[model samples]
Every structure is written in structure tokens, then in C-alpha cells.
Target chain A: MSRFPAARLAGVAALALLGFLLPRLLGGSAHVYDTLTTIAIFSAMSYGLDIILSDLGEISLAHTAFFATGAYAAAILVVNYGESAWVGLAGAVIAALALALVLGLITLRTREFAFSLVTYAAAVVCMNIAANWDFLGGSDGIVGIPPLALTLGRFSFVAGRPAQFWPVAYLLLLFVLYVVARFRRSRLGQAALMVHMNPRLAAMCGLDANQVRLHVFLVSAPISALAGWLYAFQRAYVGTDLFDTYFLVLMLTGVILAGRRLLLGPLFGTALLLGQKNFASLGAYGDALVLGTVLVGVLCLCPRGLASLWRRRAIPGPEAPSLPGGPVSG
Target chain B: MNVAQQFANGIIIGHAYALVAVGWTLLLGAARLVNFGHGQMYMMGAFVAWWLMSATGLPYAAAVPLAVLVGALLGALMQRLFLRLTLSQDLVNLMIATLGFGQILQGAAGLAFGAKPERLTSPLQAITLGGARVSCSAQDVLLVGATIVVFLGLHWVLRRSRFGAAVRMVAEDPPLAALYGLRVAPVYLAIFAFEGAAVAFAATLVAPRTPILTSIGFEQVVMTFVVVVLGGIGSVGGSYVAGLLLGLYTAFFSALVSPAYTTASVFALLIVVMVVRPGKLAASGGFAR
Candidate 1:
């Protein structure tokens, strides 16, 4: 069962190489390129929340704020300051980091619903400011973002078409997936699990729960923001709609759809969701209904998520897998 | 900008906030449950009332009670769906479930009522207060009176009634209350139904003041949060006072500074409060008192 590290690395590389060809292998149409590129971008966005929701065992509803911050930062830099994609990416990370610091400190002591409430409020505040502040283009939002151009000394890559953009988006997704995998193996990840599953045990083990939470939050925001950075170039626009609940719900649904603790869960979930939106073509209202129903149904009927459903069937156990924090015994 | 008129307007706004928040106050304080779909439910209430009045040619007053009834039914439906989660006190899942329910409601409203904004008109909106220099609508007067009456009634019920005592007992410790022969599920269902009915009632009174939209679901409930949090979480009387103070704060802030930033400012205040004193949201003994 224990494979050599070199073999595992080769396997991962092969899979990534295959992913680069996935769009062409599927349909080879521009629509396929556009759809796959979106899936990759949104999946990257979902991974940010996946780390927090699945590993840290906390829901930061303000992930949308981070996502929006990146888009806006990238949009503003490219449109207003004529900055390169690299600078825009830097701006996104810095803005999200600053926001996470403030939010993390504010919500350090709060647990459960209080944490969610504060984060949700923070996201709404960001939206409100974005909607009103003319410097951010008010409701009109920042537009005319130039195509992403990352250049280095006589070598340059410009992503002006969906096919041209696919590699960048795919690379970003792979990078995020690598970061998430590395994070799951890191000491901070272990500490976050301890803090979530057993607070007293975590404290006794010499971990500061709040510090772990803050660190994890600080790390998580830039991941989503990076996705947004790419997304701004793809869309050529950034608006307050980036902070909408639809994105939040979509992110949450993606994280939980395939199951927690699985690295590919959110990626697969996002692909399925966006695929449905792209191919099936439900009107907006119907799409919302489907997304909401899926989220609620998963949490209610199969709390371990869809991945667990097949696992349960394969194992054929009488005693079902218990949900974390089961029933809170009195 | 007339100072007295703004002040009067602030009072009406304050009462409206309190009324809208009353159901959430009970749900949080008594049931120890959170509903993220709260704003959607309020949206549903207003739309249902609007639909009834428009389709049936019913009087605005008559449509309100019917809308409250529908709200109660919706609440019951939610309770039915979430009974398991409620029994377990799974706050996180419950919150998300409510959000899903709200999404469903929003989609349904969009399909049924369309996306366009519609005004919920009341006959009382036409009746004006005196002097024309500093005045309000009769609907505003009705809202203020209704808020006072509801608060007083809730206080009386929570403190002096047997059912309220049962609810408080459940809130303090559900398993223990169940062991002592309390029918826990029914209590939860009743509380949810009350939440729906009360918020729906608030919608009829308050929604007439503005144009209603299904999209407002996401943003409409922030003021309710400010009221609930500042009012000491589950304290009914506290929420009333908090609502008035917040209404005044928003009114003055909008009048003096800019209305666009008022929500951001209030949320900033919420962040400060969470940091400074989170003890206000403790899970016990803060109900009607």
C-alpha cells in the first residue's frame, strides 16, 4: 500500500499533464475551452474555503470578500494603473491578507454561529462599500481589464483567448491543489484539526487555538484571491456581484458536494456545478433552486456528502459513520 | 432636511426594525436556533401579501393576516424539514439549511412574482400626520403602535404564561426538559411558526414604505442582526430599545453623512461589539427579561 515517493510524484505529474489536455480531449470547441477554464478558476476559488471549512472546521462566509478583493485589485491595477498581471496578483494577495488579519482578530474568540455571523457581516460591508464608493466604480464596477500578460526578459505570455487562457487557469488550479495538499500535511493543519475536534486537547498540546485559526485564515484568503486575479483577466471586468451570496453558496456547495478532507472534492464539485450551468442551461431561478436544494439535501440527508454515500455502500456497515461533533452530549 | 421630521421618521423606522426582528428574537432566545434565511422569509411575507391583495382584490388589512398564516405554514414546513437538526441542536447545519430554504424561497418568489420591484400599498399610507412641516404617515403611526403592543404582549407571554415557561425550560436544557415530559418537537415547531407569523406581520406593516424585490433577501436582514445583537441576543425588551437606537443611529448617520455607508458603519459597530463583549449572546436566561 505504501508506494515510493518518486512514483507518487510521477503519478501526480502525469495527472496534471493529462489535465492540461482535458478540454481538447472532451470536445475541442471554444465553448469547451471557456467552460473548462471557468471550472478551473471557480474550483480554485472553492479550495480557499475548502481548507477553512474542512480542515479548520470553521465557515468563513467572508471568503467572497477575499474573492472580490482579488478581482477588484487586479481589475483596478490593470485598468487604472496599467500594471501587469504579476502586480495585480500581488495586490490581490496583500489586500486579502490585510482583510483576513482584521477579520481574524475580530473573530478570534467567537465560535460557531458568531464566527459565521461576523464573517457574513464583513462580506456584506465590503459589498456595501464597493457598491457606493465611486473610486471602485460604484455599481458600474471596474471594467476594461487588459488581457493577462506575464513577461520576463524577452519572453512573454499573453492570454487573450479562452484557449490561450486555459494553461494559466489550469496551472493555477494545480498550484492551489498542491498548496492544499501540503497544508493538509503541515503542522498548522494538524493543530487546526486538534483545535476543531478537541479544544482542551489542543490547548493541553500547547497550541494556541486562536493563533492557528488566524494563521489558517491568513493563508486561505490569498488562495481564493489568486483565482479572482485570473478571473478578472478572463472576464475583463469586476463588479460588486463578485460578493454575491451565489458565489458564497457555490463555494460552500463545492466544498461539501464531494465530501470534506478529500483534496479533489471541491474541484470535482465545482466542475459538476459549473458543468451543469454551462451545459444543461437552466434559467437563473432554476439554477438557484438546484444549487440550494443540493446544499440542503447534502447537509440534511447525507451529512458526510456524496463521497461518503458510495463509501457507505461499499462498506455495508450497520452503524453509520458519525458526524463530527455529534449531538453534543449533555 | 427638517430635524423634527427626521426624528419622527427615525421613530417609525425604529419600530419597524423591532417588529421585523421580533420573530428572530424569539427564535434565538427561546429556541436557541439561528435562521440565515430570515431576510428571505421576510421577503416571502411581503410578496405573499402583495400577491394576495393584487390577485384577489382584498384589502391590504385583510391580506396581512392571510400572509401571516402563509408565513406560519412556511415556518412549519421548515421545521418539518429541519426537525432532526433542531433536535440535535446542530447550529452550523441549521444555519446553512435555513440559507438553502431562503434560496428556495427566493427562486420560488422570482418564478411566481417575477423579478420586478412592486410596492405594497396600504390605505393608511395615504393618511398623513399634522402641520405638513413635521409629519409622518398613518401607516407609520400604526407601525409604532403595533411594535409597542407586540413587545408588551411578548413580555407578558414569556413571563406570565405557561407555554412561555415551557419554552424557557426547553431553551435552558432541551434534553432535560424532554426527560421532564416536555414535548420538545412541538415546542420547536411552534416557535418556528411564531417566527414566521411574526415576521410576516412585520412585513405587512413595514414593506409598504419601500419597493420590494426578491433580491433584497440577502441584504434586508442586516439591520435585524444589529437589533438582535445589540438588544442582548434574545432579550425581547432589549431588542425593542436596541432597534429604536439603531434606527436613530441610521437616520442620523444617513442624514448627516451618507446613506450608502450606513450599513457598513453598523456592521463595523457589530464587529467592535463581538470583539469587546461577546458575552451578550450566552445561551441561557435572557429571554423575555
Candidate 2:
């Protein structure tokens, strides 16, 4: 897919290096490391939804459930079984996939608002279960999660602080970015776009739309789960708050803010949002108000996202900037 | 178990759910617009009335109407913001925009009302009806009465009135309605305003039964979704029946099964219905029916 593979590889390496040095370049305060690590983890989480929203052309509000599933799974595995972070990662993936499969099948026959409503209800039900179920620690949540420890035979590294965690978070973010980029160019990715844009055409070409949706959903769940696995360690806790609408709104805004289908859009969007919250927060309510306003404003004023503004100005004509899969209004 | 008492409780709760979901039913039936913010709007309505009564010493009767007016204005404002998307028939963006609006309302409510839960007391709540077997507060009676009146009035207006015809026409085909000189935009605006007002009215009446908090909207919306969907996605009469059935089911389920998992059980019901009869979800024929 790349015209210049060598140059692209070099570019990726440079970006990774810069990302790793970003905290130190900002004086390497614990706060800086913390903020950047959070941005990375969250952007990775957002990417899971990014594929579904941007490429698959559907809104699954249940992504939050997949996210929460990952965190809860990791917390349960590590906290209850005294397992390693590797096992926690495996548990997170398995649990998230199990959830994604059920949700995918339940919603397979529905579309548009029906799909959205069901997914949303599922997330809410998940949250309620998390809060009320005694086996999951009830409302108190599972705390005292040991710091993330990844050990191999005769070699080990642990992340117990924000600074120490930055590398792991950054690596995860890069891995996610690479995976998303590749997925966009993959056959399933192409099929998803085709199914979204022209279902009849896709069908004529022998594509099973439901199968593609289910496959895409299965692929997306583990990505968010990976982020949650890391998050279980970052906060040293996993609570029902992981299923908050705030996170759902955040993922949607992050995916849409910088324009869909862009590899770096979610990452940049997450950075901008987290940067504001970290440095210039106006308390909880104020921050929420700001986030909500930004989401609404961006959609109302620039439905094509901020990237389109520059394109429109550069092209100057009655012709609208041609979106990749047409206007996402549908 | 006192089956009679639970039955009465179910009737009152059913009416409350129906009242809460009426605006959404109209919006969906007439305009095919989904307001994810409906729950937050309910939260705001309760808080607005509570704030008015507590802060200005206004009577509950006066506070309710004032809050309804505010909700109407908020709805109109939302319509204005969503006008472009609505015009373009961009359902996806419209849905997300409403979600953002809901978040904004929630945050603003938190800032304005504080995080602490507040009670929106009614004078009628102090008055009990019926004897020991199946007693309910006057407020509950009022809620049931108001719900019936609103549903009957809405049913009449939608089925028999000229304005109802125009709304149904718009819902059926916006372009054709506009070609026939229906003034489509005003119909949408009016539908949205009614949605806001109706939900606020529901909030004013039903919110007194529980403590009001910004966070309460989350659970409230889930119930609303159940009613709307089970009612066949926009059926005014169907929603009323669905709400009643759900209320009875909830009452008995909480009593016999587990109160903690009621929402989960209700959601499971929705999933089952979706799987068994997916076509009902896509059908919009309930507007006129």
C-alpha cells in the first residue's frame, strides 16, 4: 500500500523515537510522564472504536463494554489468580472476544439506530452488572492491583510508576497504530468499507456483509482489551467507571474530531483532549462541559472534521471536498 | 407477596415510564430522530424544577410549567444546531450530536445543581390514597392521571388533527410533503419542542419518586430505550402498553427474582425480541397506527 516502504519505515522509527523522548523533552516530570502515558493508553483504546466507526461505518456503543471487559478480566486474573501480566493480557483478549461475539450476533440483524440503541443498552447493562455483582467486587471495585510485571526466563522488567510505564504504553500505542494502518489496507478492511458504502455492490461481488461486520468486530475488541489490560495496571484499579458514558463520548469524539480513516487522527485527537484535561482542566464538570461542547461543535460546524477545513480552503470551489467513502451522514 | 400491591405499583410505574418515553415516541414517529440526550433532558427537567422550588421558593405547580418551558427552549436550540444534519438526513451524525448534547446537559447540570442528590418534593406526595393493601401517594395518582391524559391527547392529535396529518406526512416523505407545501422544517421544530416539553412534564411528575442526580439519567435512559423499542419504535399507544407490561414485569421480577438485575433482565428481553423479530425494529409504520 505504501509507495515508499523504506521511507515510511524510517518515518515510523523517527516518530517512535520522538514519542519516547516527549516526556523528557518536557522536563520529564512525573506529571508529564503520567499525562503522556494516559494519552497513549487512551488513544489505543480509542483506536478500537476508530476502526468500527471510521472503516466499518457503524457505531457500536458496546465498545465501552469490550473495554471494561478487558480491564475487569485483567484485574480478575491478576488480582485473584496471582497471574502474570502476560496471562492478564490473554484473559483480557479472550473475555473481550467472547463479549464481542455475543454482541455482534445479537446486533447482526439490526442496523442504524437499532444497532446503536442495543449496543448502548448492552453497555449500561454491563455497568449495572459490574456494580451489583458480588463476584466482581460489587460497587467497591477491584483495587490493589499489583504493578504490571512482564518477566521472561532470566530477564524481567516492571512498570510501577508513570515514568517507567511510558515505554510500555508508547510501545502499545505504536503497535496499535501499525495494526490499524495495516487493517485499513487489508481485505477485511476493504470489504468493510465496501459493505458500508455500497452494500448491493459488495453483495454482488459475493461479500457477506454480516460476516465482515462480525469479523471486524472480533478484530476490534482485542485492541481495546489490550489498552484495558495496561490500564488495569496504570490506575492499580478496575471499576465500573470504565463503562462510563464519558469514555464512550471520548472515543467517539476522538475518532471523529480529526477526521475518520486517518491513521493518526485518533492519536492526535486523544492528545489534544488529554492535554487540555491535564494542563488546563476546569474541574470535572467544567471539563465535561468542554468535551461535550467540542464534540457537538465539531460535528455541527465541521462534520467532515478539522482536516476538511484546510482542504476546503485550499481547493476553493463549489465542489465539496470529496470524502473517502462519501459524506458520513448516512 | 402482596400481588395486588405489586400490581398497583406496576400500574403507577408503568405510567411513569410511558410518560417519560412519550416525547421520544413522538420524535421518532414524526421526525425519525433519536435523541440520546432524552435521559439527560429528564435529569435537567427534574433539577430545573427542584432548583426553582428551592432557590426561588416557587410552588411546585408553578415550577413545573417553568421547567417545561426551559426544556422546550433547549429542544428548539438543539433543533437549530441539528438543522443541517437533519436537512441532509444524516442520521448517524444527528445521533452522535444528540449524545454530545446529552453530555453537555449532564455536565452543565452537575455544575449548576452540584453533585449531591436532591429531592423534588411535591405537596401531593404527602397525601396517600387507598388503604393498607395497595396504598400510593397522591403524587403517584397524579402521575397515572397525567400519563393517561397526555397519551390520549397525543393519540387524538396525531390521529385526527390537521397538525398530526402534517407530521405524519412529513414523516412519510419530507420532500414530497415540502413539494405539497407542508413547511417541513416547522413540523420538525414543533415535534422536537413537544418532545422536550413532554419529557420535562414527565420528569416533573415522576422525578419526585426518586432522588434526582445528574448520573441518574444513565439508568433512566435504559428504561426509556426498552419502552420505545418494545413499543415498536414509535407507536404512541404501543409504548403505553409496552410500558405497562414492562412495569408489571419489573415489579414482579424485582419482587420474585432480583431487584439488582432488573435492568439486565429487561435488556435481555430486548435482545431476545430483536433476535426473534428484527423486522419490527426497522418498520416505521407505527406513526399513524
Candidate 3:
């Protein structure tokens, strides 16, 4: 009740600060670094999906197409043309963005069921092309992708193993988060909320509802593609399944369950989802079970997502939309 | 086989697609959302019938209907359990939830039934017709026959019965129907269960003809979905026609092209239809005028 209404948030932030520092202080060992790298990659990818889900209320189970496209683009550039990792990364984002634009323009003009059918089909087609095309290594994917190089950056991750991936992944995660945060606050972001709220009203206000959605979708796709690119690069190989259905499902669960009702929900969802890769017996299924449970639970219980927990505690500046006004299409 | 025989084989495949297509059309039209888990239900029905008649002492007639009932109950459970929580979310989420539900069912089947193909006994021997000699096994004939009967029955129900009126009323306008004393929720649940029964029935009919395996559900659902969309989303009759058309297309196409593109070709057809007239597939607002 005191004037400093949410002192608990400060404590939470302090704890986060300490936890993050502890990893660096402990000298980011290989095993620990791999886990951290996955967390960063997963979080960044989840945020990309939020453009469709939490921001626009659209569901994109096909985001993995973007990821796979980016990774392949990067690898193809490096292996075929001898480009650096940064060039590959930039190229991946551009490729993802272009595909997203075309996909978004066509699919978002329609309503619920149609939206799903088109997007899912698009992703499946992409996976098929990748799988069947011999140049992409058919089912084998691109192996032996050279380590992403750096010329001008102060923080360069000279990769010998996946553990070496953290520094580069961490930087990419930071850049993605920073850019997305800014994008969320701009007029374009507000236009997104407007279009989602009531397209008729948004149109009345002189906004092109469909165009705005297309823009957001295009943007989100590249982000996903960037994540895919990094994942493929980090792992040093891309396989057919990299852009296939299961990848899409995992990405959807993370982003949708994240509930961008607050900023932290997607991050939390990503951490929980990718973490299930640990248990030996559960294996591939463990992530799926957790996804099913969390999706059902969040849809039923905490529609706003875990991030709302942070948003609820007396923070007064931003007036984030309540979960009921969630951006998803009904 | 002669060239004519190959063409005849395509129609046989069309018959298979018809069963799934009709079910998908009716369900999506009435339910407002689709169940990706439906293929799983079809697989279950087949497996259940396979187990009952082929393994246990129960006869085929009893097993088929019995399997249908089980599928309906599971459908009701899906509605009562998952859809119950999801009505408030975006339809996109609902679709994904159903897909997740399908995955859960697939995994559960893998755990419970094992990932092997099983066969069921056909109740009736194949019947010959005209100059063409196609063996209509009891199960296949029964299934295709049941599909025809169900369509006629659905047509009658939609055009005639009070239950049909309630469904049309609600789908056309939910609140207005509620004002007219139609109970919307129960009718919706009934439709969900009804669709499940259809899928199960299709499975019971199909099990004798095709190899029953865990992977069969995905193909069945995709085929059904394609037919439903092609026929136009909410038109029950459109589904039947579309189903037959697709069945014929795949039947002939496979005879010409490889079997691999059969599914991909269906998807391509859907994309073409969608791009041409987006509203046709929407299935609401009464056939886009």
C-alpha cells in the first residue's frame, strides 16, 4: 500500500540480475552454455510467434518454415558462396520476411478456418520442397555449415562446439529482443492492436487492416527464420525435419502458451518448453506432453499467461491489454 | 488390368474419400470448429472393430455399431473436455489445440495399441455389378452404402426435422435461434458426437479394405479436410460431391502419376480453390451468394 507500490518487482528483477551474473561469473562452461544457448534461441523464436499470437491473435503453427528457411539460406550462402555467418543471418531474415509477406498477404485476408488451412499448407509445401530438393541435401539437410564468422564485432564466438554458440546466440537474442520491443511500442504496433481489436473500426480510422497484419506476419516470419538459421548453424547441420510439422507444433505451443498479455510470458513459455528436452525416458514426447498440458491449462486458467504475473503487480505505466482483449482471432 | 479397369479403380478410391469428406463437411458446418483429432477417432474405430470381431468372440455387425458408439462418446468427451475450455480463445488456438489433441491421441495409441497394422474381417463378400467385376467386400459395400444412407439421412434431417431446424438456426444465427427456444449448447455437443460417429463409421467400413495402422489417421484426416474445403466448408452436400471428385482425381492421378503426389495434389487443389474464391471455403453466410 506504500507509494512504492510494487517493491516485490524490484526484488524479482534483483534476483534475475543475480541469476544472470552467476552464469557469467561461473565462466559459462560448455554444458551450462548449451542450455543457456537453447534458452536464448527459444525465447527469441517465441517472441517471433507472439507477432501472430499475442500481438495479432493469429496462430502460426508454421513458423518453423521461417526458421528452416533462414538456416538453409545462411548455410547455402556460406557453403555455396563462402559468406560469413552474419551475412547468412541477414540473408536468412530477409528470406523469411519475404516468404512471410507472401504467406501473410494471401492467408490473413480470410477468417479462422481458412487462415489455418492456407498457412499449414504453405508450411507443408516448404517442408516438402526442402525434403525433396537434392541441393538442400534432400533428407540429410545441410551439414558442415561453417562457423558464423565476425570481422568488426568486439564479442566474437570462435566456435569449436555448441557451447561456443552461446556468445553469438546471446547477442542475437539481445538484438532481436531490443528491436521487437521497439517495434511493439511504435505507431505500427498500435495500428496492429487497432486492426486486431475491430478491423472495421481500424479501417474507419484510415488504417489498412489486412496490410498491417501482413506487415507484422512478414516481420515475425523473418525472426523465426533467424532463430532457425542460428539453430541450424549452431548445431552445424540442417535436416528435413528442421522445418517440418513437429517443429511448427513446438513453436506454436511456446508462443501461444506464452500469452503476451505481458512481456515475460513468451520467454517463460519458451524456457519451459525447450527445457523438457532433458528427461531421458520421456525423450521426444516429454516436450509434447508439457506443450499439451500448458496450452490447455493456459487456455483454461491463465489466459493472460505467466507474464501477467509480472504485469499485475502495481506497474502503472503501460496498461497492457487484459487477456480477454487478447489479440488472437476468434 | 485394362485401361477401363484402372479408371474403375479410381472410383473405388473415390468411395474411400467420400466417407471421410462427408463426415468432415457435416461436422465443420455444424460445429464451427474442426477436430484434427478426428483421424485418430477413425483409427480407433477401426482398431476397436478389428479387435472385437477379429480377435474376440463378438460378431462384425455388433462390433461396428459398438465401435461407432465408442467414437461418439470420445467425440463428446473431446467437446466436453477440451473445446469446453477453448470457446473463448481465438479459433486459430482452438484448431491448434485440436491438433495437439490429435497428437496426444496418436501418442496414446502408440503406447496402448502398438504401431503395427491390423486387419478386420469383412462381414459381406464382394458383389459383382454390370460388365465390370469389382469385388465389393461386405465391409466396403456396407461403408459406401452407409455413406449414401447417412447423406440421405442428413439431407432429410437438415431439410425436415426439428433437430435439423435447430442446427440450421444456430449455425445461421446463434442468438436468434436461442431466442426461438433452440438449445444451442446441447445441439453443438450432439453435432460433435455426431461427426465422431461418422468418422468411426467410415473407419469400420474402411478397415477391411486398407491396412489399419497408426499413420493412417493423418492421411484420412487430411483427405477429409481437403474434400470438405473443396466442396466448400459448411455445405454438407458440397462435401459429398467434393469427396467423390477428389477420390476420382486421386484414383486416376495415382494411376498416372506416382502415389506420392496424390495428397500433395489435393493440397494444391485446395490452394487453387482458396485463392480463386476465399469465401467459398468459409462455408458460412450461405454459399457466398
Fnat of the models, one by one?
A: 0.49, 0.75, 0.24
Q: How do the predictions measure up, each by TM-score?
A: 0.97, 0.98, 0.85
Q: How would you encode candidate 1's per-residue C-alpha lDDT over A255-315 as one tens digit per residue?
A: 8788888899999999998999899957887788788888888878876678887887789
lDDT string for model 3 (B22-51, tens) is 656666776667667777778888888887
Please write out the lDDT profile of model 3 over residues A1-330, one tens digit for every residue: 245658865865676566455446657676667777877777778778777776776667567778788888988888878888778878998888888877876676675667766666666667667776777777777788877666666765467575667667776776777668777898888888887767789999999888888888877887778787788777788876675444665666666565653466566667677666642236444445455556656655555565555567868687665453254434
Question: Interface RMSD in Å per candidate, to 1 decimal?
Answer: 2.7, 2.0, 3.0
Cα distance off (Å), candidate 1, residue B107: 1.6
**Which residue segments of model 2 deviate by more than 4 Å?**
A316-326
Which candidate wins on lDDT? 2
Q: What is candidate 3's CA lDDT for residue A147?
A: 70
lDDT of 2 by residue, A172-262 (tens): 9999999998999999999999998889999999999999999999999999999998998999999998988888899999988999888
lDDT of 1 by residue, B1-289 (tens): 7888788878889999999999999999877777888899999999999999999999998999999999999989989988887887777677777878888888788888998999999999999887977888899999999999999998888889999899888878899999999999899998999899999999999999999998887888888888998899788999999999988888888999898899998998777776677787555567778
Q: Which has the higher DockQ value, candidate number 1 or candidate number 2?
A: 2
lDDT string for model 2 (B54-111, tens) is 9999999999999999989888888889987787678888888999999999999989
Off by over 4 Å in 1: A317-330
lDDT value, residue B1 of candidate 1: 77
Candidate 3 docking band: acceptable
Q: Point out the worst 10-residue segment of candidate 2 chain A by lDDT.
A: A321-330
